[model samples]
Target: MDVSARWDNACRASLFGSFSLSGPDGAHIPISSNKARALLAMLCVAPQEAMERDHVSKLLWPGRFQAQARASLRQCLLILDRALEPQNITMLEPSHTMLAIEPSIVRSDFEELIEALNDLRIQEACSLLATIGNKPLLDQMDFGDQFRAWLKIQRKHVEGQLQIAVSRALVALDRDGDMDGHAQLSEAWLACGRADARHWDGKIRIAVLPFEQRDAVGGPFFLAEGVVEELVSRLSGVSALAVVARASVASVANSGRTIPALASALNVSHLVEGSVDRFPDSIRITLRLLDGPTGVQIWSHRYDGTLEGAMKSRPHIGANIIAGLCKAIGVEAHTRAARTMTASREAYSLYLQGRALTYRAIGDGVLDKAIELLEQALELDPDFAECWTALAEAHVNTIVFTPQLDRVERSQRMADCAARAIELDSRQGHAHSMRGIHEWTLGNPLGALDHAYEAYRLEPNNADVTARLGSFLLYIGHTQAALPYVEEAIEQDPVYGRNFAMLCAAHFNLENYDAALAAGQRMIDLGMPGMWLAVIEAALGDNEKAVETYFRQRLLMNSVILPPAGLAPMDDDARDAYWTIASRGICSGMEDDRAIYCQILDGLHLAMPDPCDASIALPAIWMGHAELVMKLYRKQIHPANMLGLMSLWTDVDPIRQTRLHPSFLSFADDIGLVAAWEKYGWPDLFPRSSHID
Candidate 1:
């Protein structure tokens, strides 16, 4: 440990102070020289993963001689070691390639500064007196161009880190169920951005229409208002649905249009309209789904439950109505949806009221209320597949951040309930979705993919189905493959919350930074709070005035990373294929990540034998190392340790690729790719661009 410290510490004499080896207790060591200190700081802050020598070379001496720079660095290291001895630290060691910091117990001012700065950002009250009192590094001496660049980089990074911390803190206040804190933080971020901050902020949209009357007699507006309020609470489950408040919607309740026209007047895709007919025996309510664009009836249904327990039951019924509407638009019903609907209806109504209190708590606890409702619903009808599904969904909902439940428990319960649902109705895409989640949790990638695909197969037009599949694809790191599905999901049901985010995230896997930005903006426009929104916004250089709402995330009690982590590389079939498509799409415009699209298929030179989606695939019998590009061609995967996984792509069977990409000429004479292209339908497909490669 002693020797490691000596080798690792980049201690040197500071121009502002005499040699020392002491912390506040005077054991801190100093850097050997200004240059050495800068070099050390530069290396320490470099992205932690592997880095090439060329990067350092480019940063230090863009137009200078390498030998001179190396000599300067070596001299600084020697002096720095001597300066570090008092603090029992070493700054560097001889390695196979280049100098590296040795494992050591050396204290570093840079590290301390970073920690201090980050802490300060979180709490403005954090004392900077110690930092202010500290002696400056080489304060009087000129550090030169290389050192200057390093300093600039450090300052940029430090400020960025601080901003993120502050923003995150403000956002947290909003998330831990604090509306006032949330509003304050959101306003703060927004104000800062609007004033001088580089980042842009998020926007909000809302729609409110007349409540379906339970009794045309117009008893207490509370019941009618409450029912509408309850429906908004249910729909808000979409997460992205900014269901306008009853007060706001009341202004337009008398639009006099049908559901479709009413929705149009409200400027929303969904319009909820109904009339409560009273009879001697029970209450009859008629509801309708209207296409806001054309003012046409998309779908309509009627319910005949009595008013004996209508207040509490209305919200759940409303949830069922919304879910039914989403399903009609082709959204897959998953376990999550079931949980939201089946939780305690009365409690859920309270929860809806709770949402109105965005003035008060977050909507998260709605799950607990939902669980209660579902439990009660089950008590009333144990064999009800809907009830079972909702219970499973409630359990799964808890899995997102529960300390008690493991992922396996969530996956298993969801699967079991879904299986039960399917036992009752195999055509239920939502049930299969649960089963797929189980397969994914169990490390069966193919099974997961198959289940997601099956859900789609069962309901080709379902938005939720496509959204769920896209989510599954993205989670597996096959982001490129998720794009089409996500887009279709959003298209099928534009109101499906988070669908746009999913679509935007798909671009991250392909490293399509620009497209990712556009996607983030779309979400902000629709109202979503996520890392991707900030990231893509950053990637696109749009630090205008959006994304301040993300500050609402910073106000909670938790310690969260801001801007979050960057996306990892695409290491699977799904990922590679998506990227291949994205890259080709960038220079070209391949719409599909499927193998049938020769653009992406052209990058693959491999195959899969037991292909889940593709009929013809490569065999293990004649396996070969897959090239990066080729791997992208196949949408397949191999799970890692039941948690991590390599993404999948389309199959790479020789026979399949022949049909998918076609490496041979039709006449069997020409061996060139152009001849193969000629045989394939590239000219017919992408008529705007011919194959240049």
Candidate 2:
């Protein structure tokens, strides 16, 4: 074949991640040695695809004698050429004075990226950039200092050019009034920026308002909710856009505020609003993309389709909305790959409705209804991974909030649902996260760790994944390692109550009592349950605040009994049982009552093995049930336990004298707790003398 034809049908080299050449059929052509691979990469990234022999030798062998360097270079080239020869393509052209790749014989993705940018083929350039995808150039290879320096400069130059091309493309699309094209480009541009270490905080933030329902007669009112949910889920996957949470949008959705006012309230730069009209055979959706600050409609579209057709077209409609918004702001928006699928529209809609209901139906009949809806969804489409994952999550919530249920059976059901989700789609991060929680509840810490790590890897920016991983680490007694992940989760999702709760637990474990108390208070302020706050207050010796917090929680539970329609479900029996136990402990100083209360609460909350004994021990200590606390401590320190370490805190000082017990001392010795105390001193919140006391 001629050179150009050969280039088209010959092996191509990938310089990103690991250096490797792939033949025409996409099989790897292994180079003989690291030096040979390095030499090839050096040539490919070199200016004009050519380098003088003397310069190449000096760069690859900076410390060697000139003759020795040149000899090494020649040997490396021979190895590389031999490796390329089997592919029937000329990769390198060598001469007495210089070496170069034949102009039309080989093509590099890096080179094509530059060519695409030069031609203003931004979309093609962006696609190629995704292939490189933040990987360091010739990532695994270690070369001489001179060549490394050249590689660094070249990588930076490539990144800069990619960023400029993306910026130019976005501007051009906006100027041409091609909103859909601009939206499609935004994701790729953001990916490039992220890979190049550019900040994306300057990108426009958009919120999708809950679509209003008009003239609906006995159809699913939740169809609007399902559509809005799908749009939000899809848009949130776009790294270039910051999507406001559905809860935030729903809070002011019907306030009759102007677009500018609503946008300011939600802290968003743009808004997407739509109205859904349902008829006998079809659903019509009219959507408008609005400028948040100016209340201007940038783009509007009307879509008419059957329910099934609308379900299938939601992604395309969402993309169009994003495109219009991005174009309005002189940027690009790229639709992310869809991660959810369902063969039945009814199943898909039911899943969305189930998720919505589940979020609102904690601990009550509504949760059961949500579960029923999800079960119906599964019956309609057994392969619906999202429904399975959602069902697993709903079961987990039941395990946490509905103590009246058969805890063991519920836990097993959760595990089964999560496993089914994984079987259907192992790549779904939600499945892995749910499975991790299931494993954690089963007291399989190592299995939990594996699933949690995989979930985090698949969805690094997902706040829920971050929280789960951090919580898993904390539960396993890796308090220090878990702190940053929890903190980052909080940063990413400041409004999330669970993140703050995890932070509180982490800080308390670290013996940063003041910080822990502050986090606990923040959780309470956010209208989340704060049973832990009372414990923290009691531990800090604020008995009055602890007593007040106890009553406040009771009052909160009372109010929840009459919760607004469709909100969190109320389990009166479970609430009453909890109250009866907790009230006895608080109402009197009787040690037996306190101990009973602690044990019952442990049975309720410690549905799984608690390696650190925090579930039983912390509450016992808070209630001043010193004897029961010591018993729980002994159980935690047993030799058969998987975790050799015990989490100690300053709050346990009232039982300091118990350290002299044979079991306590032996446990300390077995876990090196005493040695840790002697070497590193007591944790920041504890008194040094308390360890020996």
Candidate 3:
């Protein structure tokens, strides 16, 4: 009766599809008691193969007295021991206080499945998952409420893992050109329906590659790209699907990568690719929907029409493409009808030209020209919601990128255009996004968040909207919640540099300096301002690099003068003094609010700006002047400057210190942050349970 003597090394427990333990010879070991099987499962899934005896008892035998629960657990262990003895398996190692599974003696299929997926053993993972075949964990067994709660979480976790694994396997199969295998596996996966569809979770992610212009020797090449953008916008409305951003897809469209490589790069489940061939007065468009994982063509279609006819029929074509894709993917295509932006073909063409101009408005007078074009488009069709959104966007670019322009006038125009776009079509995500930006500029952080969330709900797949939501959340100190949105936006549009900046901020606030540094480096690589990198580098105890980075940023900002010499060997206090003065110089050559900011940084006690800018509080916060921060907080800063508070949560040296101050909670409470935290979860630096202490 020595269980250790009969221990079988090949014993394996199958927790998915069915609950069974098999011996080395592939024979099922009888485990008659469901509770015993549940007990085995509890141990297998538990971290480090161990769980406290009391906790395990409560989970398995909830509602029983503590002593009775303990007794039941003991009885369950004995049943498992007896069942495994026949297979020569010493399945568990139980002490008076803890129960531990003996991995050397027996292993679970779930563990093997996870290992296979992690190691990219796609074939093996697919095979193991196919056995589960969408079946619920433990099949027909039901446990107590406490146990059920634990099971529910585990089930969700497993479902997520399996979905990713299966998706990857399909992609791998497609890459290898195994069509039959892909077909079989696809069927198996479809049979196992997914349970999570919230936001972008457990959704079909697709990227539309820029359409090829076959006769581009002199034809309208931009039209090809326009087709892709139109399709991307149309597909983004589907709740069951997430579309990759046009910028990312376009960036890689001409790289000549294989289908599988394209899918991998975009992190998508499907790809839409096509070519546009020009005729004398018409065009021939051929579109193909490929399974993202397998590169197998699920559907293909060709449309031939006159140039004018083709431009006007884009909505109908997009609908057909969406329908075909959804049908092949086994998902419902619940899409809103595309609104006609303009009745005039000329206006629609002008709108496309103007919208494209806004994307690359860094050149001299580019934004001005885009604004002119969009305005003309509106002249012909003033009710065009999309054109209004595009006009609003152009105005915002002028406000932020063109410092020479009239900021107040541009801001007003941006707000009015956004309001009009929303009035025309409340469902326009970009319109809402522009309005969100306008709200933040007006110092209404809460209103900004409301508009941002509405934009996200309207177009969850849009990289810009997703990134904006993350940015708005970060502004209000919701760093943890903001992290995933930033991450998802980066995945959808990796080439867009702003999301990486947001990513850096999120990681920095969470005190993840290494990740923050990496993200900042990426932002820099993408040609964005790397001012945040200096802060992250400083946080990681690299003051020399931090100083170098800050100086470089100031130089880029065209600072009139540099930090004083002989600063390298300066003590911490002196170095901080130099840093504060140098940081203030970042706003050099600015006017209005920015000029006020510089004055505040210089420590000249002038009348405070209408909005108590949180950014202006940075020098004091970094100097550990908690009282100053509190004073500013009490000033009831303009609601328009509320978004600027994001600067206060950068997790720099004194930020954490400031939050830890005795009066910090009172300040937070007065600013309505405590209530926000209570509703949306506390920030990383100010956990609800620990901040009070």
Candidate 4:
């Protein structure tokens, strides 16, 4: 037996003993059987601490009866004891204990490698990690058939670490030397002819599939979403990886698309697929990775963990899968086994609910529901910066345009929420963007720009961050700087509406209204709200048509607010906005009865820019309740959400209505003036495009 070691170079070492392993002095011993020699190697490199008794039974006895199992376990232990005598190593008898046997002494190559890595010796970590590279583990496994779940877990953990160490080594080599050294270092990692380590290069495309419906599917199904979400969260945490976000990949699960098709559609080189199943006090999961384009099966495994006590510790299952897949792919897994953020199952469950609602159609009470769930997430994890940002955004969406709360009150609340989130963790781009928006719209533009820029810098890869910041910049009138960010945002996410408006607005302010109008037209074509489109078209010298489009949008807005006549899905907020605007005409006091499916504009409170509640009261004559209309406004009814006020006396007779409430007579002048203008055929607000042509 020979024991040899060199830190920088490959060392020649011999597993010496009576038969398998021996002492540093090269002592000798003799084991009668080869199976005993093999078992020693097996237990020696069990990856983790120890191999237990049941594992030995499953390995050799496999499907054999009671006598065969007992005999095999006894023979294996006796052989292990004899072979390891030289090294003073001994296997726990029957080998059925919880921990594996640890060698008493070693000249083993692995010992030195472990010592070096533990010493923070980079050179040793690399050389040692490289020594164990994908060489055969237990080349003569007399027990290959015994791959138990516990053994599988240990293998996964070690493999994950090996890949991470390999990647780290490659990185150190790259930083310390020339390209050749980096190339050679990378080449050295080519175990089994693939660089499949979990070292996620930023250039690699990644596609995250939607989590399996843990709850939707039933009992354990609820955990499916959390498993997938936690995995995504962990992968993204590996700073070097260019991991895709759950939101973008959610459409796959949300739309029920097949995994293979999604892989191709998303154009990622790899795919992770899995399902989570649950029983009382236990959770079982199945997962695998595939070569996305080729559909070749890469790796597949199942984990049956007991989530008996803490629900949150369940995310580890997801983390394990990700870490496992990265190991399978040859990427480094730096996952320190810990319960962070959503360590408890309860918090994970709430996080999933919040994520699920994020893409739902905007409606009254919907955003509020999401906010509630996110608030719960924050409660579960007060230090979770991501959840804080989500909650902050939910707050913003709640009063985006409620038109009820006072501006100062609402704005202050929004700013405070955004500020607290940013204060907790400024590195979070979403938090930075949220606070930047509050500053830009209600506080200081200069300060807003600084925050927005910081957000972009932090999350350069996220289009949402860029688009949101660009939109905020446009709102604050920083059109020039806004354009490039918006352009990049569009490049990142072509169809999302937020930045499209800002992109168009940039052109609009640049006096390239044609481009702006084209952009707006695209938004309109896609069924998005026409707010920016109308503005862009008007800027492009199409004011007449723009006004027509604007009025049409207002009409739609009004109908949207009307709560739908019969079985209409009035939950859409944009539609609600349109209906509100339509009911309150910009210049016309005259009724567009056809627009509202009515005979005349009866008791519909004609919105007037008066200091009193005369706007609604003046129209009461047609319907007859001046006091009732006054009380409605004073009751703090939101003007933007007046859905069902279509009353009697609703016909066009402003005079008759005003007569009932003399104080409302003043509105008669404005209505009459608007009426005369309509009666005489009102002229266009801007010259026709045809005239310009």
Ranking by TM-score: 3, 2, 4, 1
Q: Per-residue alpha-carbon lDDT of model 2 for 93-117, expressed as tens digits?
A: 8899988876455567766665564
| Candidate 1 wrongly placed segments (more than 4 Å) | 1-272, 277-281, 287-364, 401-407, 537-693
Candidate 4: segments with Cα more than 4 A from true spot: 1-202, 214-222, 237-247, 250-253, 256-273, 288-301, 308-320, 323-344, 358-361, 377-384, 401-411, 422-426, 491-495, 510-518, 534-693
Give candidate 1's error at residue 43 in angstroms.
49
What lDDT does candidate 1 reach at residue 466? 67
Per-residue accuracy of model 1 over 264-364 as CA lDDT, tens digit each: 33334445565666555676766665544344565777778666556446546766777785554333333224222323444333333322332211244
Report RMSD (Å) for each prediction in the order shown: 21.1, 21.8, 14.8, 25.3
Model 2: lDDT of residue 484: 86
The numbered model that scores best in TM-score is 3
For model 4, state the Cα shift of residue 561 in Å.
8.8
lDDT per residue for candidate 4 within 185-250, as digits (tens), equals: 455556333244333332344555654545323432346665665666566555555555554465
lDDT of 1 at 194: 20
lDDT of 3 by residue, 1-693 (tens): 112233345577777766787887778788778888878876765324378898778677766788999999899988988987777657689999988987776666766765564445656656766776667776665665446545664675456445655655665566567788787767756765643453256666788886777773573345665676677777777777778887777667677778866775566767888998876667788889886645778788888887778766767777887787677655678887876567677787788788878877576678999999899989999999989988998987765554332444566688799899889888778778777776654545566677888998987777888888887788668888888888889866866777877887787778766567667876775667676776665556555555566656443331222222211244556556644555433322223423444455546323423223433454454444566666765654432234345556866554566666788777776666665566667776665684443
Which numbered prediction scores highest in lDDT against the true structure?
3
lDDT of 1: 0.44
Q: Looking at model 1, how many pairs of residues clash?
A: 89
Please count the clashing residue pairs in each candidate, in the order shown. 89, 7, 9, 43
